[model samples]
Target: MAGLRVDFGLLLEPLGFIKVLEWIFSIFVFATCGSFQGETTLVVSCKGVVNKTVTAAFAYPFRLNTVAFSAPDPEGCGGAWTDIYLVGNFSSSAQFFVTLAVLVFLYCIAALGVYIGYKHVYQQNSKFPLTDLAITVITAFLWMVGTFAWAKALANIKMATGASMIPGIETCKAPGITCRLASVTSMKTLNVSVVFGLLNMILWAGNIWFIYKDTNLFNKSNIISQSPAMYSARRI
Candidate 1:
């Protein structure tokens, strides 16, 4: 009859403590990247009319190309320009990053529950530690892939929405119509998200060593190498 027994001491161990950090960092990774909403304004100066400020807004799961803003009115610009959209289709990378973070967050919660409440059962069962190690390794790899993709996507998003894009806009190229970027929402939080993502990867990768120690493989190797007599005695 193995019932849940809370063990507060596990919180001090590397396995328990690192899981806590992974849980917290996972939240940060998703909150900063998933909840992000940004806007960029393009100031359109045209002959014979007041300068028009066109605002383009974008948000999480950013599919920038899908986010269109009305081009400066043809009547106002003295020229025709269709709706302009931010560049790039970054949804795949963005969604992958956020989805991984959310899944990792949930995993951390469940892992912590196991660490705190079922510590004894977990230790007595080699399968639990082995599974934990394998999952940790996979998660670390995913974090690395997701973080890099998201970071690259973020850079592209900045370029697509910034002043550099002015030259690419047809209306901006029209004679007597000058366009300049007014402002773009700061991506500082998204940058932090990337940082947290990297940290999560490092933490999980490092935690692998600690988790592996609890696995039967590590114990068997130690018994064979460090105490061959004890190993043979156990076999006999």
Candidate 2:
């Protein structure tokens, strides 16, 4: 009779795919200026509560304060030499990049752990026992936290700034600016981010279960090897 064969591919393949997904989404999150060569639909539309006036404040890349000529004011001030960006814009932009860095770091560590698992390499180092389990657990926890904060982190700004799921006619918001949006706006980044966050939760959950199974398999194999040795000693 033929014996069964064990292949670690079942475990590693999914992890690889997960890494790919995370990498792609990380680009969207880290795209501070725009996704396509300095072009994006991300902007703030502000409306005055009293005057019902609107202003369109476009998003710019993160940078230190620079003294520059004022942009032509919507109030028709013909532009002035003033500081750029509002309070909300700077805060949100900074946070998005920070979150991107954290997620990318976690994803890299997870990739390394997956490599060690499939290759069965460096597994004997007791310096840090069960490193794979640690990686899986930490990654899952981070994913959980990220998903929980999905609303506040990514959704709030997109939604607040006139993000629409409908095919036509989108809107955006800012403190005192509003305008009729004519550009074909897109929210691909926010959509992908939400989807990625959900999948990450499921994949990490499966990873934890797989690690438990692997550990038991290892213990059983060790016992099976010792059984033949003990029998031979008795026969001697």
Candidate 3:
């Protein structure tokens, strides 16, 4: 017959909270990118010496598909444009996939850990595994890579759009219409995506710290329990 079970508080630690937060951030970044459909438009104005004026338009739109994607920013004047927006869109899509992988891993590990801990709490001699620490380290690196990709994408978009907006003087390529950029505007979810991405990166750093601290405390307790003095003290 078994007596009262020992107080294995480690099995009831707050590690699950971090796991929950991890999933939340991952889903948040994904959703922000998904529901976001943004476009950039540049309106060009041209004036002829005969007191007549004409206008041209250039638009860059982003599109994503479940099986494939493309980056197209065509101009009305048939001139090829910069590919910054393309790169930015690709980066966002990649980040979404990476975040999804991380979310799945977090859910699995958290569930397994909770289940194992629950079983151990009943004195079944079960033990928590160190796999989570490795997972954290791996995901941290992935997060970093994803973060860099996002930064590059955003930078490229800004540069491309700004450069394209500078519609310098142009001769009448078309019969009587000369065109120059009048105004440029971008409407996209890049702002929200960027904000969420930054916060996600910061949260990842915190998660690493929390895991280190918790594991350190756990290891120290084990070491103390194995100490000769402590064992003797317990005997007395």
Question: Who wins the lDDT comparison?
Answer: 1
Which model scores highest in TM-score? Answer: 1
**Residue 207 lDDT in model 1?**
97
lDDT by residue (tens digit), candidate 3, 8-111: 35434555555655666666665655444443333332231322223222222232112111212234234422222212245454455445545745664655
Model 3 C-alpha lDDT versus the unseen true structure: 0.48
Considering summed lDDT, which 10 consecutive residues are worst modelled in model 1? 73-82
How does each model score on TM-score? 0.92, 0.48, 0.55
- Candidate 1 TM-score, C-alpha based: 0.92
Q: Give the per-residue lDDT digits (tens) of candidate 1, residues 1-236.
A: 26899987888999999999999999999999999999999777776655788888999998989898766665655555557888888999999999999999999999999988999999998889999999999999999999999999999998998988877887667777777788899999999999999999999999999999999999888877879787777999
Is 1 or 2 the stronger prediction by TM-score? Answer: 1
Ranking by lDDT: 1, 3, 2
Cα error, candidate 1, residue 37 (Å): 0.6
